[model samples]
Target: MVIGRADLHTHTTASDGMQQPRENVRMAKEAGLAAVAITDHDTVEGIAEAMEAGEEFGITVVPGVEISTSAGGRDVHILGYYTNWQSDDWRGRLGSLTEVRDNRNLMIIEKLRSLGIPISLDEVLDEARKQGKDRGTIGRPHMASLLVAKGIVDTMQEAFDRYLAAGAAAYVNPPRLNPFEAVEWIRQAGGTSVIAHPGLYGDDDLVEEIIRSGAEGIEVFHSDHGTDDEVRYERLARQYGLIVTGGSDYHGERQGVVFHGTIGSRTVDAGVLKQLNPASR
Candidate 1:
């Protein structure tokens, strides 16, 4: 079958993305995407708006959330798709997680301030607002945007490499769930859990372990993955009978990583989507 256009990983104003849901959908349609998933960091609030916009733009919007979890002292992001959005259980879990995220962000800001960076929580929130991002639970990408606004660093990678990297002067680890717990929560919420950007983590064994712990898929086609890493991850997924997925991990201009439609070629197939949500089949 000919591959169709899809982007399983994307952000919007509901998280740290520069575009609003409507604008994102419009851009996706313009870019010739058949489907897209708004996998906002730690929140699914953008799904409804994305869905509405998708309907208007004649594209499919997959409900998704990127949950931050921990393993071996490193952060692992698990993408949850086709979740039960209205479930009280899901809301309670997300509320608790959001509180943890907010506290973590405040602590990071305090550390940055102590280092004489002069960044305030209000400044971060203001930056997010200026970018049309949600203010309730600001993320590092949003903070990095603030740094960019102040000319601290040219890009998000530089912001992290200079100050926010683990063991850096202003670095602090956030409270996080274990990988198993994160996958189980996604499963309980009636969503498929996929490991996001394994290439960034540099641990193929851990990816296999996550699949063993009920993660249904692996992100094999990420913008950051080199050709060899992509081939290796694809082989691993096939060896373990896991669904293969990919995306640009788009965060708009904040990261300066890649363009919105540049990574459109990497997409989860419709059969994989059906596997993610059997009802879709």
Candidate 2:
């Protein structure tokens, strides 16, 4: 009988997600959600449409973005909530990061080619185009799809295992923000920064470092988190006096939409939103 009212992490066609912004809103409404955060990766392109659809569908849309950063040699995702997406200053920042992402994709493809994988940028673009993902957001997952299409890999996991994963032959570090930089940018845009899925990252020590890095909140409810993980993060949030947010991290069926009816099988209420961003209330 538990109901979900908010999903603080999600994606749309503006990034690697399968659905368009408006369609994601519709899905949220259909699931009886009152609010959903469109935390598209590195780009705020989908926010406008999602907000528009939210109005039409009677759902509250939190304008957010998931900025990819690196710390301790691991990819860390920082979620920004209630951010001002219309400012040129903010857009310029994301634009630069997107440019870096594009360059990194090319480098990865070059490494793959060098490794005799026969994967090309064009092939990856074709897969991303089919999925309707944005240009700046083309990533290894898109490349993996091309590998599958070419029968070079059996699955996306295999593609990553053989080539794209960190420390793999094709791996290359891209331009990235440090933890502090990521938090600063979100705050600069008048948003609250939250560490996305602490459990997915390294040990509790690293999570503590992120908390100290100026993140105002932490994601406690995620499809990737189990009960112990949730409890651990919740305790950490309380201990550190940081806001607690939750979401399904919904990408789509292709990304394995296991928590379909709820946001990671944990209902998020409006109080968490208010805590994370007073403006959200």
Candidate 3:
């Protein structure tokens, strides 16, 4: 059922998403969503701009962040909603992640150079600036885009396929938070921690462990979810008594969904928002 008007997961140039903070808000309105979260990866820089745009566009902007953590040696994303963005602890936690990101960026560039890729961190940063992604934390995508610009690869996808993807020549595993630590950080900042895109993990045992890790909710509805995936996650939510959260996981064209199209793509029900942002409710 299309029970509510909230997309609790989305991104912007604040991290790796293609759209800007304000642009995503305006698009949320166009997509008929009453609320959208600015859950940029490891950064809250776009939250304020999104809230301001929400005011202008008549959309509710939920302050959120997607923390990248590792589980079973693989990357798992945790979505923190209704956070105290200004809290020192919150800011500090995210800031640390950015440091890790920066270090990883340097390492990745070094690896690329070792592979005779003829790339540099400065060139990647320049490409990111050209794409307006400089204001946010730089990531592998920026490096991939740089490869494209330098004609080292024809597209970001090609860059990933050949060198940057996991197990590729230039791939480097970076330091990241573990699931439990991430959940504790979110709860300490007075935010609800959620498991993002559980379908991608496909590990039922891992789902149970995440709940035990203190995750308050699971992303049961997502633009990437098929019917079976939704059903599976919905059952998991019910089994664990967890709040059912959903979102488009919008990342602009960089992802499968559009900036605004995600509103129509997934349904999270108004009740979930009430639980996530009781103050707003």
lDDT (C-alpha, whole model) for all candidates: 0.80, 0.81, 0.82
* Candidate 3, 1-281: lDDT as tens digits: 22448888888999988889998898888888878889999989999899899889877788999998887867788999988998877888899999988888889889988888898877877877877775879878778778877898887678888988777888877768888899898988888999998887767688789898799899988877789999998998898889898888877764242533354477566557778863654
Tell me the tens digit of each residue's lDDT in model 1 across 1-281: 21467888887777777777677677777878788888887777788888999889888877888998888878889999898976878968987888888888889999888878889998988888887765335788778778888997888778878887676677777657888898999989988999998988877788888989999888898878889988998998898888888887776764545433353656666446777774564
Which 10 consecutive residues of model 2 have the lowest summed lDDT? 255-264
Which regions of candidate 3 deviate over 4 angstroms? Answer: 1-4, 254-264, 278-281
Q: How high is the lDDT of residue 62 in model 3?
A: 84
lDDT of 1 at 146: 83
TM-score of each candidate structure, all chains considered together: 0.92, 0.92, 0.92
How large is the C-alpha RMSD of every model relative to the true structure?
A: 2.2, 2.8, 2.6
Backbone clash pairs for candidate 1 read none
Runs in model 2 with CA error above 4 Å? Answer: 1-4, 134-136, 255-266
**Candidate 2 versus the native: TM-score?**
0.92
Residues 1-281, candidate 2: write the lDDT tens digits: 22347888887778877788998889888878878888888999999999899889988888899998888787888999878789988999999888888888999988888878787787788888887775448767778778888998887777788888888778888758887799998988999999998898867787898789788999998888889999999999899898888888877654343322233344478557676675644
By the TM-score metric, which is better: model 1 or model 2? 1
